[model samples]
Structures are given as structure tokens and as C-alpha cells.
Target: MAEIEHPKPFADWETRAYWEGCGRGEIVLQRCGACSKVQHRPRALCASCLSGDIEHFVASGRGQVYTFTVTLQNNAPGFREACPYVLAYVELEEGPRLLTNVVGCAPDAVSIGMPVVADFTAPDRDLAVPRFRPA
Candidate 1:
């Protein structure tokens, strides 16, 4: 069997800190310095305050499962080996939700409101993706 290559995530100037932090084992989230509202999806302006005073901060990396789906199949290239994985929306303790894979447990064992912590996968030197597992 051949090793499967993982998909690399995209990072732009507005969100560079996040991927960089992930490589360093930190979960980064952005906060609006103007109004103090924190958010994810790493945008230029705040969703609540609409201010451009955004700053990235390291997060606690603990969250509850807001939702999830068990992926029994993946047609995309390099993703077949990842079948039977748990894809989930984790609601962070810092008040943002991140779309991440829930690992370290059976797909059938995942549930909404389940406590989880961040894990990381570094496929290359330049990036790392955050995953989650039951806490």
C-alpha cells in the first residue's frame, strides 16, 4: 500500500497566524480589539463590531462538539484512507467554532456536547491542521 498525501489548507495574510500557531501546537483565534468580540474563519473585520482592529490570540483548545458527521467515504484524491473519520464542528471555550476532524475514537462514539481537545497533523513543514478527540 502507498502512503496517502493529505490536503494542505489555505492561508492568507489575514489568517496566517492561525496555521502558524497550529504548527506550534497552539489554537489561534481572532478577536476584535475594538469591541472585544472573538470570532473564527479569520476575517479582516469583526462580525459583531465591524471593526478592522483584529488580533489573533492563542486559545484554550478545549471545546464541546456542536455537531458532527461520520464520513464513511471520500472520493477526493488522497482522502480515501481517511474514510470512517468523524468530521465535526467544535465550539471552542473561547467562543468560536472551528470545523475539524474528531479522531482518537470510533466514529460511532461521537456525540453532540461531547468534550474534546485539539490534536494536530503536520503533513509538511509549513503547516499543521487541528483535529479534535474526546476529552
Candidate 2:
């Protein structure tokens, strides 16, 4: 896990699988079994119907930039070296939007409505953070 350069994740029961799957290079999302709506930021109850039935599934990993900003400065520990990066809200193909960093290109090149796809970064051995990039 020497590839990881940031903080490790501390996942609780509700988010355990989501975080663990990322470490294995998979983008997993929770889909409400009751309402059939896919979601991120795992919840015990379905966001649509408030039902306590949810299951995990691999996401398509394809999305469009809804909005974004380039971080010119940050002191949040382990993020200093990643300054001037593109931070964005990506609207996935399945309808869930996630806040993520857009890498693999110039920070200024990112634009609203641009197509993006997932890229995993193992900031810690047991944690793989998902970042997006131009597609």
C-alpha cells in the first residue's frame, strides 16, 4: 500500500462495504431495494421511500460534471500537495451525484457538463478514494 499518500478511511457499519469496495478498485453504490433508487453516502433507509431495504451494486463509473472548482489552497493535511486541483460534483449515469476530485488533466481544463469517469486512488492500504477525470 505504499501507493497511498493520504489519510486512511474509518468506515462505520453503514458505509463499510462502500469504502471497502473502493479499495478493490470498484465503484459501489447502494440501491434501495424498496424504491429502486441508487444512492451514495450510504444510508440505512431509502432516500426515496424511507424504506430500510438497501443493497450494494457496482456503479457505471460514468458521469458528467455538474459543477466544479479548482482548489488553489488547502491545509487539510495530506491535501497540500494536491492543491490547484479540480474539485467537482459529478452526476453519475444512474442519477447520484458525488463530490470528487477531477484528476489526469490540467485543473483549468475541467468544464461544466464535461464527461468524466472514475479513477481509484489508494490513499491508504485499506482505503481507495475515487477520483474522476475527463472521459
RMSD of each: 2.2, 3.0
- Which window of ten consecutive residues has the lowest lDDT sum in model 1? 1-10
The local distance difference test score of each candidate is: 0.85, 0.83
Best candidate (score: lDDT): 1
Error of 2 at 18 (Å): 0.7
On a 0 to 100 scale, what is the lDDT of residue 129 in model 2?
A: 87
Q: What's the distance in Å from true for residue 70, model 1?
A: 0.7
- Candidate 1, residues 2-50: lDDT per residue as tens digits? 2234668788998888888998888999988999988888888999978
* Candidate 2 residue lDDT tens string, 77-106: 667666777779999998889998888888
Residue 121 lDDT (model 2): 81
